[model samples]
Each structure stands twice: as structure tokens, then as C-alpha cells.
Target: MKDDVDTIALVVVLVLFAAVTVLGFKAARWSRGSSLASLDEWGLGGRRFGTWVTWFLLGGDLYTAYTFIAVPAVLFASGAQGFFAVPYTIIVYPLVFLFLPRLWSVSHRRGYVTPADFVRGRFGSRALALAIALTGILATMPYIALQLVGIQAVFEVMGLGGSSNILVADAPLFLAFAILAAYTYSSGLRAPALIAFVKDALIYLVIAVAIIYIPTKLGGWTGIFDAAEKKLTALDGAAGNPADFSFAGVGQAWPYATLALGSAMALFMYPHAITAVLSSKNRSVPRRNAAILPAYSFLLALLALLGFMAIAVGVNPVGLNGKPNAQLSIPLLFETMFPSWFAGVAFAAVAIGALVPAAIMSIAAANLWSRNVYKAFLRPGASHADEAKQSKVVSLLVKFGALLFVLGLDKSYAINLQLLGGIWILQTFPAIVFGLYTRWFHRWALFAGWAVGMIYGTWTAYNIPNPASGAQHFGGSTAAIPLLGEKGYVAFTAWVLNVVVTVVLTLVFRAFKVAEGHDETSPDDYHADAGEPGVRDVATPGAAGKAGAAAEA
Candidate 1:
């Protein structure tokens, strides 16, 4: 359907966008630090966020605009399978509860700004740390692009994407991204941390209203489900296979279960998630937030039901190229179901949601590059201020790279790239997560395993075709295991191979007396907390020497 410009909704969205932009610029002064010259201040919000701020920041970080858009889109396109996100998110907090506090403690004690920083300090291998850092940047760039896709979906629904001229069509998207990139450069992580407050408020309010109002208008959940069932069951795939609307069939259960498990493991492995965890003021903040974050999972489950609601209302959204676009289902649903002003508010929630995670991801990616790649490889003695400057500049480039993904590539291709990113990132788990608890895996063996897993995952993902999208490769996340008869999430399968290779190689290399690099961290460092004795001096050599002198005095 061709949509005219939603002038009222556009005005409301612009107003909210302006308000958030103001907050983003002023956030440099929020909880004002001594200087914004250090990565500790710029990349991490000075590591002083308490329970409430951490809650919202982490929420804004993980439950991204993509989650607000794609989860429901998958449900709208393919029923029940899309709900794998719900279980994945539900299982994630418990997994996070197990390890994140330890990560936060070690990072805080040692002044590690990125996961690669912790990996380098733990294993003493720049090569291994470089792998983790590069994978993070690779995985995150497409994700940030997905955020732009989220914002674009809203814009397209508001009729900003129907222009005959390309520049005119994408002007709003470029402008929004430019503003986000500017504030993030000037204010750093604080910009996103501050904007997360308004983002979450708008999100919760929109979701609350959507669940209540849309169901009643559609005659409740029963009616919505029936309509969806009727519509989906009648629709056949290109191969003429009837769609599975109720739940995963016998063939799909493994993929569903494994996708959830793999995603749960990979969630915390992402740099942005760790950035949020590391920014917390205390160790207990993450533990408490882990318990509380599942509340958003409940909201996500409710949001997933909006797919059925859209089907019931017969909402069909067209993309910029005038093709069928499931990503616009929720945005179009609100446009049809709600008044103009309320729809504007819903669109703003998603657009602002994009901003928070995009800022966080770009910052995380920049920190990884600056700390691991730039500092370790390019300049060994770069100062803290130098690191911060590199990150700010790189953050802008990262956003532009993502902008290219949105402008140059197909939207579904971007989505598939993000799925591929999950596959690639999960390959880092053995190096980062397992290394956290034990250093038994030889550094060389871990690197080999990562290389093997990455190659296998990419090769496997490249062969799986999506008949619906008419793509011959990289179409899905699940594939048949080599020996096992059942299909499973390719990441989990690849990870299993990764562990097997690591274990076998570790035994052989250790028996041969292969040199494992020195471990720079102590056991006690893993349990260190904020306000601990000597914690303040760990990051500063001068402070440490002065404190030693004071002790002698």
C-alpha cells in the first residue's frame, strides 16, 4: 500500500527526536566526571552507574530496536519459529548471572575496557585478543546497520521512503544517523546512557498501550490467533509446503532449541552487552539486573503476539523498492490501529531504541579497535587520551559503515548478515568465556579452534538456502549436523566442534610442552569489587606509587 506522508505523526516523531538529541548533547555533563579524555570516562560512562541506570542502560543495549522490529517481523513472516527470540532472551539472564559479575569484577580491577582487553590480559596473546576484537567489530557493524533498518521501517511507514529521488528518500535516515554519530562522539557512552531513560519510558508505554488496545480492537487474543492461523495455514511456500503456524514440527524442534541456546550464549559475548555490564558501578549491579531484565522478556513475548494481531487486521507493508516487507508489520500495525499522535509515539520509541544500542555498539566496537587493534598493533604506548580520541573517530566511521549497509545492501541481506554475525561471534566463546574460568586451553589451540569454527560456520551458513527469499546461500542460522540426523543451530553445532578441537589440541600441545603465554591476572582479581582496597590505584601508576608511599608513611 502506498502511504501518504503522516504529517501529524511525523511532527510528533521529530519533536521526540529533537528532545532526545538535546539530552544526548547535555549528557556529557551528566554525573560529571573529571574529564572526558579517558576511555574510562568516555567509553564506559565513568563506570559509575548504579542499579536503576544500569537496568535501563543494559535494557536499552540488549533489547535493541532490531529486537523491537525483527522479532515481530519474523513472527509475521514465519510463525512460532520467530518466538525462538523469547526463549533465547529468557535463558540469557540466568547465563549472564553465572559469569558477568566475574567479568565485571576482573575488568574493573584491571581497568580492562573491552572483552579483548580482558582476553589479552588473561592469556597474554595479542594475536588471540586481535581475533576476538576483529570478530566483535565484524559482528557489530551489521547489527548497527539493522538499527538503521529499524528506523527506516518506521520512516517508510510514515511515507518518507516513497520519494522518486534517492537523496530525498533517505535524507531523514541520514540526518538521524548524523545526529546520533555527533552526540556519541562528543558525549561518548553517556549519551546513550542518558537517552536510554527516555527510550525505555517510551518503549514501555508504547508496548503497554499496544498490547491492551490492539487486542481489544481485534477482538482479543483468541480472535487474533484464529485469524493468524487461518491466514498462515492457507499460505504456501514457494515449494507449496503448508506453513506451520502453531509450533515447530518434529523437524524444527532441534533448530528452535539450539537457536535459543546458541543465542543465549552469544548474547553476553557481544561487545555491547559487556560494555553495559562493565559500566555498572558495583559487581552486584549486574547480578541484580540479570534477575530483573527478564521482565523485558515478558514484554517481548507480548510484542511477538503483535504479529498475529497484524495478520488479523490484514496489514501488508511495502518496502522502499515496493516489495513485500515483513519488517514493517509492527510499525504499519500501529499506523492502522492507533491514532496519528499515538502512532508517532510508537515510531519514536523504535527510532530512539535504535539510537541507544547503535551508540553503545559503535562505542564498544571503537573501544575494541582502539584498545586491541590500534594500541596493540599500531602503537604500543598510546595514552588513555589517545585511545579515547581513536575510539571517537572510529565510532563515526563504524556508523557510516553501517549506513552503507542500509543504503547499498538489501534489508534482508542485512538481516542475514546479522545472523551470520551471531555465528561468527559465538566462535569467540571458547577464547573469552571459557578462558575466564580456566587457562587450560593452550592459546594456540584456542586460536586454531576459533579459526576452524569460524570457517565451518561460515561455510555451512553459506550453503543453506532460503526458498522464500530466493537466495541460494546464507539464508538461515540452522543446518543439519554432519553425523547427527537432526538439524540444529549452526552456531551451536560449530561451537561443539570448536570445543572438541580445542580439547584434542590442548592435550597434544600440552604433552609436547608447547609454550602457553603468561596469565597476567590473579585468582583474587576475578572476585574483586568496587570500593575495594587498591582498586582506585590499579588504573593509574602515579596513584599506585603515591598510595605505596602513603602506606610507608
Candidate 2:
């Protein structure tokens, strides 16, 4: 790791990072769950977080480091297309307000640990649960890798990376991971939960200062917008830059709308988002947080505008690889536009942003493994302590696996995979979200629809050559809609197809008298509150069904 900028900036980042490290270790005691030896305590903070804590935690969890990095970078490199994130965040809250409370109620009533666990209980299908678990793990790895990419961007801008020797250049990132892994293993979900307060506070401060300060330095908002649009108008595709992006044209109307809607639908389906929601103490926590979480969307909208401010001030960030890396634009902007001391704080915000989401994501993925893969299939009789232990170990393994994606693959590929990750996870929506209310969807049909969506989305995304760089596959997310012939997001198209196939097959199954898997939930369970008699601490794999059975009996 090298420090190319003023030492204060890098030092500031390290100091703040070290502070969070201490906070992470201390979080295990903050809420004081019954036993850290159970997934309920370790993975979900014993489902005891109140409204304020849950708000900050979900804010920190959803508004990730990647969100700060990529959204602005997209606005910097492309144009209006990056703004899709803003509307999607807006759309998600109402949707979350409507369904998440039901999910929370059922989860607490039956002691469900992961969404896959809920899928299993709701549908009584192990194969389907495994499908959901595998999809979540697959979708989350690239997302976790994206967080590393966010950190790498900060390091590059700080002059800490960009070495020819792989190990030497990435050593600092590895160290950060080491610290994050240690704390997450020790504190579980609480590490990020506790640290989120600082993360959000730093973020609000940085964003507030940036929107007010940066625009003034650049001749105000109008000038920033004009400069961004003018620069966007004058784009020649970079010769070898895979990071090059296309500005969407008039036809972008459909694609942009679909992208926003698809993203909104898909966001909550992510294991990390679900984990955050499930960690809340009651049904009202999610609904209330959903109403307030849009505050982050406002922050995000302001953050995206900074891309234009970067253009206005002429902040050009060259990556460690000696290319114009748009992702580093914001960090470089702060370093160039702000005083050295404040710039350090901005860098810390970016780094800490990566940490909160990364920690939550790792825990979520590990919970999926422990609950659905290990306890469900490998060792059906694994105890609560055993599940917790398996999760801690797998959380470490998940971090290492994400590291491999960063070290071994192209950073752009990781970004592409994250986009694909959305598409992949959205497929599960038919099974989980729809299953939340209705059991009419045949389990076999749900599984088949999920597979269809996964295969079709991956294939379509694979065929989309990069509009900017002309890469062969997985180039971007938008494609020509199948029937409308209008350009639209592949995920939405795949989701529509998934829904159609599921509906058709459901009817076919009904005609043929196919068996519907036994559902372990009742109508009353969907609205049960925290104080209800059946509401218990989270259940392990083999135990959730028993808990529900006993509650009913």
C-alpha cells in the first residue's frame, strides 16, 4: 500500500477505520442477546433491535459503500441512467411497508432465521429452500466483492494501491478484511449494527457538506449540471477502457423506468436486506423504518448529483491501473475540492460505508448456509450452538471467497456480476414474495419459474456486449424487450417471464391434480406480533417446524 496524497487524508481514514474496529468488537455486548451461541443471537441480534437502532442499521445496511461509489460513478461516466437508483429506493419503501411487516410477523412467530428458512416452512419443500439458499449465496458474493471494490477505490485515490505486485498492492485491503472478519466473527450482525450509527452520521455530514460546499466551489448547481451534460455530450469511446459506459439515448425511457422498478422489487429480495429486516424486534420496526429509509434515497440523490459536481470542478481520477476509473471520481473530488482534513473524513465515510454493508451481507450469506445448507441437508440434527458455530465459520469462508473475486477477477467483471446478481435474486421473488401471502403457487412451479428466470436472465445479460467498450458478454443490464421491442432491463423481462411461466404451470398443475407441498404457516401467523404466545426467539433448521407445530397444537 502506498500513500500518494497528503498523509493526513490517509491517516484520517485509518483512524476512523480503527475506531469502528473497536466499536465492532464491543457490539456483541451492546444488545446482550441471550446467547451468542445461537444463530438468533449471533446472526439476527436476537431479533431485539428497537425502532431507532433498526432504522440506523437498515439505513447503514441498505445505503451501502457501493451505493456511494457506483451511483455517482455511473452519473460521472454515463448520464441520467445512474439516477435509476433514486427512484428505486423510493419505490421500495412502500412495497416494504406493505409486505415486510407480514414477513416479520411470520418470521418471529415461527422463529425463521433466513428467508430460505421461511421458504422451506411456507412451502414444505427442501429442494425449493436449497434453490433459494444457493441463489442468495451466488447473488451476494459479487455484492460483497463490490464492497471490496469500493474500498479499493478509496485506497487508489489515497495513493495506497496501484502496484504491479498483486500482494503488495492489495495488502492494505487484506488487512482491512482481516479486521472486519475478526469483528464480524466475534460480534455477528451487531458489529455492523452498532457501527451503523457512526457510518450514517459520517455519511450525512459528508453528503451535507459536499452538496453545499462542492457546488459553490464549482460555480453552483446550474453550472455543475451544464458542465456534466456538456461533458456527457462529448464522449468518444475509450480505446481499451472496459470501464467506459454508454449514455442512454431517447429510447432509454422504457429501460430507465423498468430498471428502477426491477431494482426496487429486487432490492429487498437480497439476503442482506432480508437479514436487516428480520433483525428488527417486531412488525412495526420494518414498517416504520421503511417510511424513514427513503431519507437515504434523498441522500443518494444528492450523492448522485456529485458526479456532475466532479465534472464541474474537473476532477479526473486515474486508477492504480493507470486508467480513468470513474469509481474514484468522488473520492478524488473530495481530495481536490476540500481541505486535507475534511477530505480525510470523506474518505473514512466511503471506507466505513463499505464495512457496514459488507458485515451484514456476510452474516446474511452465512445464515443462508447454516440454516438451509448445513442444518437442513448436511446435518439435520445440528443444535442451535452448532448452527451458530457453522455460521461463524462460513461467514469467514464467505469473506475469503469474496476476496478471491476481487483478487482473481477484473473489477469491472465484479460490477457486472453485481448487476447480474440483482437479476439472479429477483427470480426468487415469485417464490418468496408471492408465497408470503398466497400458497396457491405450486412449489414445483415456483422452482421451475425461478430456474427459467435465472437461465434466461444470465443468458441475455451474457449476450449484451458492452455498449462503450464492445466487450462480448455480461456487458450491461439493459436489452431489447422481447415483445415490446423497446429497450428495457433484463431483470424485469425475466421477472415477467418468470411470473407468466409460474402462472401457466400453476394452472396446469391444478388441472392435473398435482400435489401441493404442506405449508407450515397459517393466516394468523402472518399478522402475529412480538408479545403473542407463539413468538419465540429464532429457531434452528429442524426446530422452526416443531416450534410452529407446538404453537398450533
Candidate 3:
């Protein structure tokens, strides 16, 4: 539980950071398209990435710094409930396998960069697309802020110094984020797409080594679980409490299960997630990646073991102002066990892992702003180059904003922003997801749903109280809604209420023959592929076939 990073570890960390910075600059050349002028290329990496690249890109973007630190941290603090991340990640792939291909096909054929692009095309309403885009960008900001939180955790572990010197604790963080902002601005999605390989490799190496070596240090798998159970059981505070405490509580399996499901539903709605999906060369790439990517789930299962190891090794959270720093469990475990050099690599991996997703998220958010807000309202006739330029500038600003979040904001508050993101973005499901299949709901009704859901979700989240933290409305997802009268339900519960209102209002509006927006897209658009004739806006079947055959022959 002390600052133990060695000089050798520091050198290795420096080397890896240098390698990633170089890779960021080099990414601009990896799959250079005919031009970087258009959103199709700049915003989406030319929309030509193969299945392999996309697998890594989407995997890297989705399984973020929080996924690396927070899941294990939760497990170390709680128990089996933290394992919900594993099942949720697993469950998400099947849903992606089924839905994302259709989304990909439609987006590809429509020249859509953001999901809002498709929403506008399908709904024939600028306001609807703007709403979806706004939701995406807003949801993604806090999520990006949490990525910085991951990097900060890594710095706290690696620097291993007192926070008395603000400059010492924060100087390295500023430098790292500055490098990330520059590269993402210069290279766009290419930076993160290329660096994901290193990020993932380091993560696998650290997790694999920890799984084999750390468990041996604690005896074995049996000993590790036993020690964890014993430690948690010693904390029993109630007559009916379970023998081993989980993160949430005893006898509340449904809340965790529902939380997992709700999280999966909202995951794809995040602008960053959708941006990665839209960048694929073909629809099948996303489907194939979904099927194969669960291999990370296997790794996540190993990462969760770090939590139990923390318990077995008796790595108690250090007292910072008399509060346990639950986030330090993994870092403490690694420092205590690994040699200097390997621990350094582990620290660098987490720090660099934060950058990869953070860059992509900023780009995604910036694209939403340029395309849905700037182009939609301000510059109706803006060129692709103009949109790309605007996005690059916004991406830089986003990183700076994340820097402020890390420097000034509480880490728990940042995490609550992420939960709020989930709740707010989930409100768009009725618009984005259902809009993909049908236009039965009136556009105004969808707008009403989004507005109501956003207000209710934010208000509810704002009012919840945490007795432990003395914070109002946003401690952690563990807090509940009084109206729901259910435990373990938080943001997800807010989403459910949002959906019910959406459905009921849609029915009422439909019965009255309200003026729903035009559906410019047809059902056939969802099935169109790159090789299909007239796939993009310029072609129909006859013209599309000629183009494909020309390219082939």
C-alpha cells in the first residue's frame, strides 16, 4: 500500500508511451483513402477497415479504461455482483450480432456517419436527427471523462507520491492528455484504431500474468475465492445477509441482472460506439466481430480475479481522508507482487489504454456536433472538408475539457456523469433503435419521449441520497428510486420509465392520425450491401450493379 514503482518500471513506462505517441502520428497513413475531405473518411476511418481492424477498433473503444479498472475495483469492494460485467459483455455480442449488421447496411447505403444521419434520413426531420446527435454527444462526454479517471488512477499508482505537491501529481497527467489531444486532432480515428493493438496486447499480458502468477502467490484459485469469501463474510452487518457480500446486496439478483441488460441496450447508443460501427467497410464486419470479440469476455473474467487476489493478499484500501480508496486494489496488488519493470509496463498499459478510447470518444462527440448541429443548422450547405475541420477543432476542445474534469472534479462525480450518460442515452432507444425498424411513432412523439425521459432521469438522479458519502442524487448506481421501491435499480430504472412513456404516447398519437415525419428510407435500405447495385445515394440497383461489376472485373 505504498509508492513502490521502481526506476526500471519508470523507464519501461516511458518507452511504451513514446511508442504509442509515434503510432498516433503514423495512423494517418495506415488506410489512406482517396481523400480525407469527407465525413465518410475522416469521421469513420474511410469506412474501409477490414474485419480484423474493426474487431480491434470496436473492441478497444468498447472495453475501455473503466472496464479495466472499475470492474475489478468493484469486485474487490463487493463480490459476485461485480461479475455482472462478464455476463453483460457476453450478452451484448448476441444483440450486436443481430442488430448492428442492419445498422451498418443502412448507414453505408445512406452515406451516414452518425446514427443521427440515419435518423434524419428515415424520419425526414432535421430536428429528430439533431436530438439524437445531441443525446449521443452529451452521453459520450462524461464517458470520455471517466477514461481520464482511468488514466489518473494509473498515474496515482505509478507516480506513488503524496498529493501534497499538486504539480507533481498532475504534471504527468497534463502531458499525457496533451499528447492524446494533438494526435487525435491530426489523425482522427486513425490514432486510436492503430494504438488499440498495443493497448489490448498490454492488457492481455498483464491480465494473463496476473491470473497465473498472482493466484499461485495466494495459494491457488480455491484459496483466492476462499479468502475473498472469508473476508467479505467477516463484514456481515445484518441478520439475513448472505454469507459472502456482493457489490449491491443480498437477495437482490434481479437488480444486477436488469442492470446488465439495461447497460447492454444503452452501450451501442453511445456516440463513440456507433462511430466505430459506422467506420466498418461492410455490415458483416460488425456481425463477425461481435461473434469473435467475446474472447475479451474470457479476459475480463481473468481481470475480475484481481479483485479476489486483493482480498487474499489482504490489500486493504488506503485511508485517504478516512475513506477507502477502493480504486487502488489492483494497482496495490501489482506493485506488491510484480518486479519493477513488469509493474511499470502494467501501469503504462492502463495509462495508454485510457488514451486510445478517449481519443476516439472525442472524435465521435466532435463529429456529432459538426454534422448534427453545425451542418444541420448553421451551415446547411457545408462541404465535407468544412465539417471535418470543425470536428478536429472540437476534438481538441473536448480533451481540454476532460483535463479540467480530472484536475478539478471529484472522481465519483465523474463516474456519476457516466451513469447519467447511460440513463440519458437510453432515452434515445425508442428513437434510434425503433426508428431502424419502423416509423410508426410520430416524430414529435419521439421528441416528447426524449424530452420527458431526459428531464425525469436527470431529476431522479439528482434527488437520490447517499448516507455514506453525504452526497445527494449521485453516489453510485447502488442507490435506488423511491418511487420504484426496488433495490439495485438506478439509471436502468429511469430508462424503463422513459420507454413506457414513449410507447404509451406513441400509441395515443398514432390513433389520432398525427403528422408523423416522412420515411425517406425504405425497408430495402437495411439489407443493401457494398456490392449491391445503387447502394450509396448515387446508385440504384441498375447503377449499383454496374459499379460493383466494374470494380470486380
RMSD of each: 4.5, 5.2, 4.2
**What local lDDT does model 3 show for residue 165?**
72
lDDT of 3 by residue, 382-439 (tens): 9989999999998888777767655654453334546667877888788788888777
For residue 516, give model 2's deviation from the true position in Å.
0.9
Residue-level error in angstroms, candidate 1, position 124: 1.3
What are the per-residue Cα lDDT tens digits for candidate 2 across 349-460? 9999998999999999999999999999999999999999999999999889889867754454334546777999999998889999899999999998999999999899
User: How much RMSD separates candidate 2 from the native structure?
Assistant: 5.2
Q: After aligning candidate 1 to the native by TM-score, how far in Å is the CA of 552 from where it should be?
A: 32
* Per-model lDDT: 0.85, 0.84, 0.76
Most accurate candidate by TM-score: 1
Better of 2 and 3 by lDDT: 2
Q: Once superposed on the true structure, which residue ranges of model 3 sit more than 4 Å away at CA?
A: 3-5, 165-168, 238-242, 247-249, 319-323, 407-409, 412-417, 467-470, 478-484, 537-553
* TM-score of every candidate relative to the true structure: 0.95, 0.93, 0.92
Ranking by lDDT: 1, 2, 3
| lDDT at 292, model 1 | 95
Root-mean-square deviation of candidate 1 = 4.5
Model 1: per-residue Cα lDDT over 302-359, one tens digit each: 8888878889999986776677778888899999999999999999999999999999
- Residue pairs in clash, model 2: 2-159
Q: What value of lDDT does candidate 3 attain over all alpha carbons?
A: 0.76
